[model samples]
Target: MILHIGQQKSGTTYLQEVLGHVAGPLAETAGILYPASIREVLPDAVESHERATSGLLGTEYPWISAERAADERAKWPRLMARVRAWPGTALLSAEALSTIRSPAVARVAAEFAGAEVAVVVTTRSLDRSLPSLWQQHVRNGRVSTVGEFFDLLARQRDRGPAAIEREHGLHLWRAFALGGLVRRWAAQVGPERVRVVVNPGSPPDLLWRRFATAIGARHCADLPSDDVRTHRAHRGLTHVEAELVLALNRAIGEAGWSRYEGRAIREEILQHGLLPRTDRGPRVAVPMPARKRVAAWAEEDLADLRATGVRVVGNLDELQCSAEPQDVDQPPVAPEEVAQAAAAAIMAVASRDRYAPALRRRGWRARLGSRA
Candidate 1:
């Protein structure tokens, strides 16, 4: 079994999308099955077994109800059953698995006790990942300003990984503290069995090709990396759009909306109302000091990572932190920009509703014609 335990925001969604689509063909050609059951639980989405992995860990993610967690918990066994049934190499990919602690890691290791388990971790440069990480938190209902977010990260850095993991369940370093993460898994699964694939930041599918090589599915390495069709559910948020969403999150909380209700409304606004619009503002950038700090942290982590002698699929030099500081150091988002973004989001939601009935009617007629 190959487990692609991910470092989130590192082209993971793209890779998972490809894996889900090519499961059948890949199985036929290379005897590698990205099991159909992973998608069967959420057939409408190619989320790559996140729920199953979450169930395995019993992670109490924010806003997840007890009923939902139990339902997902039940899926773990069913997923395992399908994996046991498959004769060929089976693959499961989930970014959430990377956040697990040492004990959880051991539990996971024991689950595939008799099976040949190989772990693959996809990573990106720390310099480049900070903005994306912050945006993700904002989307998840954080109202922290970029400066405040970096300040919190600095404090977390001072406290170290254990404290960070204990206090903040989904902190960036839980996954991106590369050296610690590698060491923990290596202890469980053996250093030789774990392969780290570094993001090279180009051509998009390079990550997938390296991933394919790591798992011994070389035939599928050269498959059209661009042709896989999947929803861009976690698209990167731009500066203005992120600020707008952050404001909305704050407003929702202040209005006394329940976390679950806020999440539903927030996601709807993000998917249909905000994300659908073109990203028209400046991209998020780290200030000079924070950039330097993260770059140094990456250096230390990479040094520790090298000492472990874990197998690496791509150039370690690619993971080096060399991002140049941007002109603005966490610039204040303009109120006008926020307003413009809010207006666009409102229009987007309104237009979607306006056309939804017509689109449904067209689909109905098409179905009738097919029946005829």
Candidate 2:
């Protein structure tokens, strides 16, 4: 089985969507089973398994509620049952799986005991990834400014690994410490079976081809190439849009809105409503002061990975940041920009509702005519 454990922001979503679109063809032609259901089941299984084992070990994981833990634990056995039943090489992809502790990793490996298990980690340079990661946190309701986020990362880097694991949490640190992540999986799956694919900046097809080769499913060439482009890249919000969302999150909390309502506001109002209209602003860049520190860390990580001798698909140098620093760091979104986003969001919702009653009436008439 091929298990793609992601260091997020490394094209995992795009790869998953493309794989999902061609899952049937890939199964038929290449004997690769990337069932659409695996997309849903894999993350649940990983999370549930992690939570269950963590509970047994008396470890506390952030955001894991008791009810959620129990629910996930209950769902895991059924998910593994599906995996055990798969007839050919199974492909499972989930970014969350990257953070699974040693015990959970062992458990997952044990479940696929008889099969050939290869672990694929898709990685990007720390300098490039930090900004993207922060943007992701913002999307999920983090309110920290870019400067504050980098400051936290710089402090964590200075304190070293133990502090990083303790303070920053597994997801954040695993992304920064790529070699350590590889070693954790390598200990169980064997270094030979761990493949790290460096994300080159261009010729987008390169990552998928390398992944296909790693999984021993070269016949995946039969799948349509256009499927990759059809899925939109998971773009991060512009500075103005993100600030607006952050402010909105604060308002939701102060208003004592229910979880459902808060989610609707974030997803429906900000993501769906405002995001589409916002221009793709400047790509997030590592703060100028921290660029050197991030590059140094990236160097250390690359050296460590080299020492471990895990199979690396791309040039190690690709992991280094070569881009020149920005002349001046972009400032926070102006109040004017925030106001504009707010106005756009309101108009978007209003426009949608304007047609809603007429659409409902049309649907009702259609249903009545059918009955008559």
Candidate 3:
């Protein structure tokens, strides 16, 4: 079994999309089973843990509930049953799996005892990952400025590894400290079975080739690498756009939107509305002052991974960020740009709400006319 445990923002979304695209063809050719809905097979507890902390918004986010627990319990057996039915290697993925405790890892290992299980972890340099990670937090309702976020990280770093794990929560820390994450999973699965793929910042298809190698799915070479979805893939929000989102999140929270309602705003309004606008602004990046620190942390992480004896799939140097820091800090995004993004997002949500009823009425009218 091939398990892709995402360290997040490491082209994981793209990889999952590719895997979904090739599920049938790969199964036919290589006896590989990348199910269309891989998460259905993971235990409910694991799912809950993922949902609770994946956003890096802290554990008080209120996503956990009895209803979700029941649903997850139901899913675990269904996943196992599906795995049992599949005749060949089964592929399961979720970035949140990186945060699972050793006991949960043991449970997953036990569930697939008869199968040859290998864990694949995708990682990138801290320089790349920090900005992406912060942008994700923005998407998920973080209101902290980039400077503030880094400050939190710096303070957490000073408190030691356990403190970092405790304060930032397991999901965020694991993502940042890639080697520590590998160690956690390797303890259960063994270091040799863990495949660490370093993300070189070019030729988008490099990650796929390395990932396919890790999973024994060389047949994926024949599958189309281009993202073929009609909708634009999610991109990092521009600095101004992210600031606007933080304001919206605060408004939504103050208005006391329910979890479902908040998600609708985040996904429908922010994700579909603001994220697709390529003309929005420059992609967010780590400020010059923070780059050196990020690079040092990355070097330490690489050293840890080297010590573990896990299979490294790409050039270790590609994981290093030795670039000279820019002289200026990230420029303050203009208020005008933030206003424009906010206006566009508001309009998108308004348009959807305005047209929805008309579309429903038209559907009803057609159905009634057909009866006549």
RMSD of each: 7.7, 7.2, 7.9
lDDT, each prediction: 0.79, 0.71, 0.71
List where candidate 2 sits over 4 angstroms from the true fold: 38-61, 162-170, 201-203, 225-227, 322-324, 327-336, 351-372
lDDT of 3 by residue, 1-372 (tens): 878888777877766666666667878887887654433554221221233223222222233355555445555555557668998888777776766555556766787786778999988877777888888898888778888888787766667666544442534675568778888888877888899987675666777778887887766665754653221234677777878887887888899887578767778876667866767887677776677777778788889889999998899888887657554236778888887788788777776667768868779757867899
lDDT of 2 by residue, 1-372 (tens): 888888888877767766766778878877777744434656422121233333322223455666666655644465456667878787777666776566667877887788889999998877667788887787787778877898887776677766544552544665568877888799988999999988775666676777677777766744656646344456776666766777777787789888678777677776556767736455677877778778788878888899889998877888886445665346666777678788877765566667768978779757867899
Which run of 10 residues does model 2 get worst, by summed lDDT? 44-53
Task: Please give, for residues 71-156, the per-residue lDDT of candidate 1 as tens digits.
Answer: 78877887899898989888888887777777778898899989988999999887667778888888888999887888887777
TM-score sort, best first = 1, 2, 3
**Top candidate by TM-score:** 1
